[model samples]
Target: MADNNNTLRTGDVVMYKNQYRATVSEVNADAGTVKITFDTGGASTVPVSDVKKA
Candidate 1:
């Protein structure tokens, strides 16, 4: 919904809220959420609006 994540997909690296660098591991367009793995090894589901292709 008007986010840079429109082109996002698995394997794409993104910046979380303009900070943490994370990799997109899964996308849930229907839920408007994305599963991301941080370079630090932690993972979480974030709203699509929280990330953008880096």
Candidate 2:
């Protein structure tokens, strides 16, 4: 499998669920999760593997 190391970070813009645009609010490498907030004011803590840089 490919490494997810260089894929994300806080303040980076990304697309989630293939639908909404979101900004990375936090990244917890130790927990393998990324916190993001969508343009619509919703937020979530998703697995690092599920997020892709926009």
Candidate 3:
């Protein structure tokens, strides 16, 4: 399996389920999670598996 840390980072634009586009605001390698800030001014932290590079 690909490691989350190796796949994502802050400032990276990415895609998620439901066709949402988000920008990476933070990365927590220790937790295998990333914080994404959406275009709508909302933010969410999700597992790396839930996101992909846009």
TM-score of each: 0.87, 0.79, 0.82
lDDT of 3 by residue, 1-54 (tens): 465454787999998774889999998878988999998789999998788888
Show the lowest summed lDDT stretch of 10 residues, model 2.
1-10
- TM-score leader: 1
How well is each residue in 1-54 modelled by candidate 2, as lDDT tens digits? 345556687999888877778999998888888999998998999987677778
From the highest lDDT down, the ranking of the candidates is 1, 3, 2
Estimate every model's Cα lDDT from 0 to 1: 0.91, 0.84, 0.86
Judge candidate 2 at residue 40 and give its lDDT: 95
Q: Which 10 consecutive positions of candidate 3 have the poorest summed lDDT?
A: 1-10
Best by lDDT: 1
Local lDDT at 45 for model 3: 95
RMSD of 1: 2.3
- Please give the lDDT score at residue 48 for candidate 1: 88
User: Candidate 3 versus the native: TM-score?
Assistant: 0.82
TM-score of 2: 0.79
